[model samples]
Target: MGLIGDYRRLMRAGIALARHDVILPGAYQTRLPLPARIAGRVLRIFGGGARGRPGERLARALEKLGPAYIKLGQFLATRPDVFGAEVTQDLGRLKDKLPPFSMKAARAALAEEFGEADAARLFAELSDPVAAASIAQVHKMSLPEGERAVKILRPGIEHKLMVELSAMKRAARTIEGISAESQRLKPVAFTETIAAAMMRETDLRLEAGGADEMHEISHKSGHFVIPSVDWDRTGRRVLTIDWIDGISLTDPKALDRPGIDRKKLANDITQGFLTHAIEYGVFHADMHEGNLIITPEGKVALVDFGIIGRIGMVERRFLAEILWGFLKRDYLRVAEVHFEAGYVPASQSVGEFAQALRSIGEPVHGKPAEEVSMGRVLLQLFDYTHTFGMSLRPELVLLQKTMVQVEGVARAIDPSHNIWVASEPVVGSWIRRSFGPEGAAKLVAGNVKEITNRLKRLPEVMDRFEASLEPPAPPPPPPRRFAPWWGWFGFVAILVALGIWAAK
Candidate 1:
């Protein structure tokens, strides 16, 4: 019954998508089955409104489906390799804008997160929601000196998302069963990845912690801004932070903002994102222009900490070197990095792979940042998988997505922004510092410390081994039979006779 209900809901959502010409339209129309093609035509005839751009149509269809579906679209946007660039870009454009729930529901959620007494003390005045998304809503709260942005999760979001996810899982299973080719795509694993990310966002504490950590990291760079979290006022469902008033990076008017340094803003955003990812190993994964703001004082402020990404030292080094190689027009090094990182199989020729990379890098190298087609670069890189049998690394998906979005934001602010130059100050210095002699010494010291610790525990391990080797008590001797004594006497007599004969 539960599955039936979910399937019904999914069908309704599909109909809505078809009616909106999201599923069967433009280039994708050719791939549809005959039945779907006929239905799609009929729906288009009845649907009076002109179809929008592919991305816009997808956004609308996702919006109509519900909050969880909206989130699914956003999650899919990060996977350009699985979905083509056009569809993923459209998914990326899908806004999380949804109508706010009732004020009473908001109050109830806040009260649940914080005890009634604490809730009253923390919040002085709770205004209507100023902004709402698929998962949560934001409201202005009165404070002593300034206002606070209080974010509260929508009621029953977890249950809704779980149901939607189950449907997705079923669909993934069906696809895997139907098509052998789809197995390489790992549809089930992709669905699971989206589910985990969505589930994590439901927890406000983790989100708050991400913001606090980002703030600490950003403070060091002196090029970024992060608002303070009010721990006293924050709760599991509600997160409270100091309000920030700044121009959104998406705003066209930001270009003309008086006293705002657009070029510096562009450099800071690009460099700051890379530094955070490479140097600190943590970054905001969902960094669209909407999540970015330019302060009145010209600082680049980062907000909406729900989705963050982390990478290990090895991945960071690979990313930095790869970007650096492309920037330097060293396609061979770029290809080498991919092979070293096991992105491309060893069977593939390094020289041939380098030549393939050159095709991808040459167009964008040394070009103005705004003019370089990042989408094309990503698409071309994706195309290499067919030639070299390379698969996309799941761990780097968020990083790649964020990098693309960051470049778009930066270029929007400054047209002639040189990605290489903007990135060199942070990425170049990091490479030289991390891969140099001092870096080698640090790496060796870390390994030595680990070995020394293991050696110190060897004595204890030896003692345990010796204790295990100690044998248990021997079993009592078997009782002798009466015949054994007679046999022994005969043997003694025979021995005496033999000894006497030898003596003679």
Candidate 2:
């Protein structure tokens, strides 16, 4: 965007924050220098003051900025690793709920995405939007042959997102230049992540793809179910999936009315996510109460794949071992996982780190299994990582945020829900599957198989390496220049000395 556009957006954001009384007063106070404070005070004379808590004001301001900023704020709420607990909780209130655009606009978006006006004919019904959020909205609709839910991208969300996103990038750049400490957080990289996620979200097609993959993984799992995508009606701007009929986990009264076992429901949600994280290595990052539903038959259904977390084998192993270590009160093992994963700086003695881990773990270990705070334990672990300069993994940040959200939902279902206690069975199974004799045998077999495959490709690998080692062609000769006799003599003398040294 141009400078004028950026100014307009910044002005819009400032105005909106003022209007909604949503400002992170404490954070802003600490962040701004004295000069900035004086300037801010003067500006506030013109900009107006917010009316509520700083955190609330901050969330409202982002929501007012537009869909992209709203989504950014939502993502930020999940990362206590970045903003801390109080601020994250405040931002969590920035609901995606927004007023719906006209049906004409929704129809036009569908027509454009599906490449035909008759595209609406594909769905048995495409009623008015039931729920509207920052990037997309949900409608109670039907597939060509059966019941389904249609998620449609908000009309012109792309253009609005681009405008807001460009402004964000500019703001991040300016902030980076101003704050030396901001470099570690990588404001620029954060902007890139926001941009990338918003771009993917703007295209409903990507959400469909994510749902499809998750569905395959969760298909036979008894604890969770991912709604199947109705590909016939899915496109760039719209996705159709089987409509889930269940009560929100937050609604305990309703769950009870339907005879849904609260404890079982809690387990299903926790263990379900665990299955995704450990077994599939792909998991939904947003598991807030609104996104998760409990079917009458007691199955947990998950939606909203806009933000997902992925872990590699190494990270998953580290996470598993860390959790297992904590479960067994093996603080040393937990510290070792941090070192092995390169999360803790080598300069920080492992013994010291282990002692710190014990500080957090020992108190919890004495408590009954049902009373432990797994999320708090994880938070302490992350705090240690931050203290030691571990580069925060964005995926882990999302995972932690979702874990907190899941805890809230679970606690709402059953205040005494012991996540660590519930998780032990699942974590134990994963550990055995990963480290038991059978698991070790499988590991060895896989390694040997890989070696055999590499040996088969040894000739091809050597050919490529040999080809790469070939000397480069010399550069074109430089234009000849006239030189004095003294220069020539000096060059020749230097060359002679270099040759003599080489021989020596």
Candidate 3:
């Protein structure tokens, strides 16, 4: 976007925050330099003199800023340790509900996904949306097979998200350039991560793919349930899935139906995600109560696969061993896992790190899920990572976030739900499948098979290596100073790099 556009957006965000009374007060903002302190005072004065709860004000301000800001707020809600309880709780409200756009817009998106006649023929009835979220609104529909849930992307959502994210990118760049500490925190990379996710979410097909993959893995586990996507009737801008007949796990009275086992369901949801992540390496990342349902059969049905987390074989093993260490109260082993995963720098002493891990893990070893706060643990972990000069493990952050969310859901389902106790069975099974004698034999066999394949390709591999070892072709004569556009490309690239360095 143009500079004018970004300036306008920044101004609007500032104005909204101020009008809604969302300034950070006390030592936090006052600790800055004199100029910053004065700016803080001005903001506080404009922020309605702290007339309301800061968290609620913040949430309202984000809502006023539009869908992208609301999304940022919802993401922050997942990090209670970072944002504090009041703001997190208020932000939680954003995830459960959002004002619906026009019905006409929904129909237009539906017709665009499928031809008007075809869509009309496929969905016998398109009831009003039962739930609305930032990116999409879901309508209850009837198909020949049965009742289905149809999710339609908001109109012009791609453009809106892109515009907002562009402004955020500029701010992230400015921060990264101004402060080495901010650069170390990876503000730009972090913003890029969020922007990438929002972009991927604009395309409904990716979410459908995630649902299919999750169902495949979760089905193999045979405990949790996932809604079946209606493949034939789904499209890039729309998703149609079997309507789940279950109560929201968030509502205890509605969830506590005859034949339902609340505690078991809680265990299933927690174990389901844990086992799926380890066993298949792919699992749903978004598991808040609204995305979870307890069917009449007492099975946990997973839905809303817009976000998912994946762990590679190495990372999966690393996670399993880390959790196993904590389960056993072995801080040394957890520290070893971090080093082996190359998360902690090799230069750091394992002994000191283990001591630190002990401090973080000691409080939770014997506690139930509801009593233990992994958010607190995560915060401490972040502190240790920074102190040790360790780079943040991007691959595991999603898993960490999902773990917090899953724990919250489990606790809500049964206040006394013990995550460590509930996860023992699944973790034990994974350990056996990954490290037992049979698992070792299987691993060796797989390695041998891979070696055999590589041997078959040995000739081709050598050919490429030998070809690369050959000297490069003689360089062409240098172009004139006023050469063709293509000839100046290298010089232009160097200038761009120089500009970036100077900006930094």
Q: Root-mean-square deviation of each candidate, in angstroms?
A: 20.5, 12.9, 7.8
Tell me the tens digit of each residue's lDDT in model 1 across 1-504. Answer: 277876666566656665566645645658754544554555555344547777677778888888878888888888887776777877887878888999989888877888778777777598899999989999998777788899999999988888888888876765565445668888998889888988888988889999999999988866588988988878778898988888887786856957877888888898888889989999988889889988888888888999888898878889999988987888999999999999999999999999999988887776665667667788788777778988766669778887778877787788887766788778889999988998888778978998999999999999999998999679899744335335335433433333233223
Give the clashing pairs for model 1. none
Deviation in angstroms for 58 in model 1?
A: 2.3
lDDT of 2 at 445: 92
Q: How many pairs of residues collide in each model?
A: 0, 7, 0
Per-residue lDDT of candidate 2, residues 1-504 (tens digit): 898898667656655653443322333756654544443443444334455666676786786666888888887786777777767877876767789887888878778877665675774378988888877888887644567888888877888888888888977876565556678889998899878877988878888889888888887555577888988888888898998888875566787675668887787788888878887788888787788887767788888777778887667878899888988989898989988888787888899888998999887875764567666776676677667776667676777777777777787787778777777888899999999998788779988998999999999999999998999799899844324444335433433333233223
Task: Candidate 2: list runs displaced more than 4 Å.
Answer: 18-32, 40-53, 366-371, 445-504
By lDDT, is 2 or 3 better? 3
Best by lDDT: 1
Per-residue lDDT tens digits of candidate 3, residues 1-504?
799898567556656665664543434665554444444555555455545566777777787777899878766665554455455656766644578878888877777888898877776588998888788899998766788999988888899998899999877776555444455557788788788888898888889898888777766778578888898779998998889988886676886667777787778888888888888888887777788887777778888988788888778888888888888888999999899888889999999999999998888878766667766677678666658876645557767777867877888778888877887888778887889898788789988998999999999999999999999899999733333333234323332333233223
Candidate 3 ranges with C-alpha deviation above 4 Å? 20-25, 51-57, 75-93, 368-370, 445-504
| Candidate 1 global TM-score | 0.84
Worst 10 residues of 3 by lDDT: 494-503
Clash pairs for candidate 2? 21-57, 22-56, 22-57, 22-58, 23-54, 23-57, 23-58
Question: Model 1, poorest ten-residue lDDT window?
Answer: 494-503
lDDT (C-alpha) at residue 118 in model 2: 61
Cα deviation of 131, candidate 1, in Å: 0.8
TM-score, candidate number 2: 0.84
In order of appearance, the predictions have TM-scores of 0.84, 0.84, 0.84
